[model samples]
Target: MSNSSPTAARLSTLDRGLPVWIGLAMILGLGIGRLMPGLGDVLESFTIGGISVPIAAGLLLMMYPVLAKVRYDRLDTVTRDRKLLIASLALNWLVGPAFMFALAWLFLPDHPEFRTGLIIIGLARCIAMVVIWNDLALGDREATAVLVALNSLFQVVAFAGLGWFYLDLLPTWLGLSATGLDVSPAAIALNVLVFLGVPLAAGYLTRRVGERRRGRDWYENRFLPRIGPFALYGLLFTVVILTALQGEAITSQPLDVARIAIPLLAYFSLMWAGSFVLGHALGLNYPRTTALAFTAAGNNFELAIAVSIATFGVSSGQALAGVVGPLIEVPVLVGLVYVSLWARRFFTDSSTATSVAVPVTSKDSS
Candidate 1:
């Protein structure tokens, strides 16, 4: 008989077949978009203060359940782990943008609009969706939450300045023709407040109220289980809507999409692998290491898309570059989730073993 406990083997069918579900969702979305070309336009018309309402809802729904599962009270530990915090900041703010700028120029030097879009993508560090990736990889939840919140704060303050630097200053310095990106701090702040603020508040309040009323056991064991599956549902929903919206752009411009995708694939792979190695070298546990890797690898494609549309018209090549970001990111990052799980064996630490061996709730994830 297998040594696996009944509980360990009790993964929900959805959990077991996550890749299939995600693949089907993508196919379904592409089909919907292809069959109904007007659907994307109709969805685009519904917005709240320059933010897409449906996308915002799906993101919020995707995030809240994962955030609620975070042990907010334990965030102090993550904060105090200066190794993890400092590494995350350096990787996200410093190395990440610079690397993407290099890749954009190196890969798409002939395509100015696409290069600019990719640079913008790099500047907009991840403040959303990374939570889902982290949780799925069994990353440290408290660390992911704290790191994501930190990124949100930095995104609001640094995004515009960084945009100017990467788009204009650095190019001019290198004697290349500079592209000026006039992005507003307020718009980025609003995007952050809406996409990150709403779900963060809801999740915090959920844990606070649930634990206060029902105790931690009931909160985690009963309440979270009921809500845990919603995170994936929300993820699937967001994927469908987003893919549908970008279906036309994606299908029509296969060559351009391929060009954009090459750099993104490189960026994601390099950043994640580099961060994971750094985390291991720094002696971080597997969970924290995974958290660092995912946060560093992910990008705020939403902000990139919005800024591209606002700066260059919606039909511009820049917008298409922005549109192609998630098309590459979703599948690539999902693959990295499995890579992370497999790499856990190399960690060879007690915590890694325990996390892997434990029978956790749906919320505990991969």
Candidate 2:
């Protein structure tokens, strides 16, 4: 008889050693990029509304399974959590960008292009991969879905204005060199629609139909476990494609990439820790706190990269900086998932810990 623990038994081999899989995927991507430099161009040639179709496909695939796992009927519970809602808004919009602005200038003041790029990244709050991180850490899936949707809406409405504020106005005020970011609301909206909206709709529809057809128990127990692993597969695929596309850029400019990475590393750690502590103080339970921290810490790197390339050209230092965002972010956030889980022990197990945080099962075997 097998002596494997129940938790280990529940998790697939892919999920059990996710970090190893992700690392290998990254290495494979770099190899592909270095060996066949033109592959990125070939894949990117087929783009819709200025977004790459292949990348979009991976993102949709990555998002759909996680979103489908969300108990949408329970979102009203998340929405009513005023502490979580207000904290998420404040941390994402007000604190996140400002902190990145400070870090960019502090770390790479001499490299104006990289500095601007870092600030651009900061201005773009996360709308995509935070879902994966939140789920892995056993966060409140319903709350995460709601928060991601909210950030998507905010990104479309406020991205350009914030870009101007951080990239232009604030820099000018600080006696720093300023550059204009020529982004339109329509373009931003298109990104949100494709990256977030499509997958969201698909996931929602999937859950609704599956539940209707097979009942909630079968939909959650049978359907969900089957699809859950695909989310990680999509993540691995996206990582490979992304790193492959940026392989030459990363390998060629090791020093510059390192320089760009330092502040990013600092930024991710700071935002996540700060948000986690704040959530605890706000009396949020572990699941909601995990959701809050990840959503706060993650960035919309896709939008940042697009904006950088559009504004400064693909070969420019700003674009390199943007490329480095996800490269640094992926590994760091993966590590933070462990940190969040370990920290979960600190929270009181009682539902009376706060009015905002509803009771959630901490374990997600799927």
Candidate 3:
């Protein structure tokens, strides 16, 4: 039940083309902001209950297509691949966030806003791109699909609580000044509901309704193919809006953007290694191991950027940090894909050894 075949084609398109589009988005956004500052201001002023309505809408659109592709029915695999599930959860929630916190502190001690942004990035796990990464690496695509469903559900429940703990309570406990926004859990949860919950329900319903009307094959192949590009379009549109709003800040302190990127680069490298090592230690095969590694390493920048702008305002350094994330992440992950292909050879050799070492039975000798 892996949607790998369809996902593969779409991912190939995205892999080849998305970075160029994203770079153009940034440039155009910056141009718009510089050339038409009044327009950016007008858009930023359109908020609903303190959240930027345009960005929120873009976030929902970005998430919906990806979420709709998730095969919730395949979630039964959790009972079968329990170890993979447990390891993924632990790495994503526990180890990954903690690692990011340390790196942000170490690298950006004087830049609290940047540090806060990095922490937010760390807290939001990748729900969309992991499937692409897993498929490219020849990982267990079905397992990746299952984890994606679980991650989408988990983010709704845990993102707010964990954000409060890491960005607020934990900082206070350590006598460090908490630089995150002073929003309550209710506010955070509301944002999650608006951004994640609505799209998730819509996606699930879309899949169900489409299948009932058009049949499963048509739904998976035809309906999904038509809708899949929406997510990327939404992403590019959001990037343009974000950079337009933050163009002044980004232009004024260009080096700050590079400074913000350092911790992110370190976080990606460290988490990938940690997950890869842990997966092998747990005796998972290459496919499952790569799935776990990519899932752990990928961060949901769409959610992070939306929440940052909502919580801290579009012009804030925190929002700028969120914008810088995908700019760095897309290229880095593309390179990791090649690294994973090379690493596959080790797993192949391991499998060969196991087959050759099998004990012979007396019947074989006779």
Candidate 4:
């Protein structure tokens, strides 16, 4: 489990063996997907509020643990530290997504599917993953919580405009689009609401109720630890289903994965480098700088996958591009956490020294 024991689990996931877990998640997903491709669609999902979305039944089932430990009320603390909030938001949304948009087009001109994947994945920023990553990075708890809340709210408002403007039409501007595409704001919203909204609400509700019936400690100590692994395992399972959903496509165009990944890799490096330089110029702390850098750099592959599936069919090269992203992102982000730690040395600040690796749990998730 890579030092994943509950009582003393690293606040972030960088304790020792997270790369192995991320690798396992990817391998297990691909393996199961390869063995039972049809199994991915075995579960029939239902629509809520007139939306046809993947029930994310497995992912929903996984949320109980991830949400159990997060104390939602602590969200107020995020407002107290405005400096970190401003830095993280600026870097994550503006700089990061822009870099991804440019690179996705530049590196993937011939491949529309992969380009859409890069665009969708890039436009979407952190809501859930950052909570875990921030914890993993030992970032400022209040500040990170605030950013999560802020980013989610921001995406809700900005998703349609930026996603469509940047991903589809923007490509046309660059003389890159072979076909004129219509971006469905409804589909994007549906994906966000179902994949992200439901899991988060379920997590929060379960925690709130458990805290009432037994005790916060019982919920935190007993229930959450058990459920935490489920969320991750479910996440891996969903990835498998997602991969299998695109199995034939990925197999058909093996090089497409690398092609899509190139821009993602470049965007990731640029965002990280940009944030670190920005933080240094602005004289932020290590923890804060890492938070800024990673918040911009890492992606929300789950929602990205949902959007790809809805917008471009599950097996479309675009969706395949989205799937390939996390395969690169997980290990790379974990590796970056360590690299950020090393990079912290260059910052010459005490707080930067603290925010180096990814934490396993998000104690402040609201």
Steric clashes per prediction: 0, 0, 0, 19
Candidate 2: residue 248 Cα off by (Å): 0.8
Name model 2 segments beyond 4 Å from true.
1-12, 350-366
Tens digits of lDDT, candidate 3, 1-366? 234443232234454465587688889988887787676568868876655687777667766765676566765654488899999889888998899889988899899988999899998888765655564455665567667667777787788788888988999999887865544555545655676578778978997998889997786666765666666677677778777876766777789988998888888877888888888888888767888899999988767876787788777778889878876776677567667756766674333221111011111101
In terms of TM-score, which candidate is strongest? Answer: 1
The estimated TM-scores of all candidates read: 0.93, 0.93, 0.77, 0.77
Weakest 10 consecutive residues of candidate 1 by summed lDDT: 352-361
Q: Put down candidate 1 lDDT per residue, 1-366, tens digits, no spaces.
A: 242533223344456566787788888888888888888778878877778888888888888887788777888888999999999999999999999999999999999999998998899899888988877677888888899999999999999999989999999999987999998889999999988898889989998999999998898778887887888888889889878887777777789889999999999999999999999999998889999999999998888888988899767888878878877888888888878877877786715422222122363433
Mind giving the per-residue lDDT tens digits that candidate 2 earns over 192-234?
9988899899989998999999998787667776777778888
lDDT of each: 0.84, 0.84, 0.72, 0.63
In lDDT terms, how accurate is model 4? 0.63
Better of 1 and 3 by lDDT: 1
Model 3's TM-score against the true structure: 0.77
lDDT of each residue in 1-366, candidate 4, tens digit only: 344432233433424456676677666666666676664455224444333334356555544344444567766654665676788777767777787877876787677777777887887786655555554555554455456667777777777778767766766787766433355666656655665677667767886899899997687666665555555665555555555555555565778777877777787777777877787678777666666777777776766766666667655777678778776776677677666655645655644333222224332221
RMSD to native, candidate 4: 5.2
Alpha carbon RMSD to native, model 3: 9.0
In candidate 1, stretches whose alpha carbon ends up further than 4 angstroms from where it belongs are: 1-12, 350-366
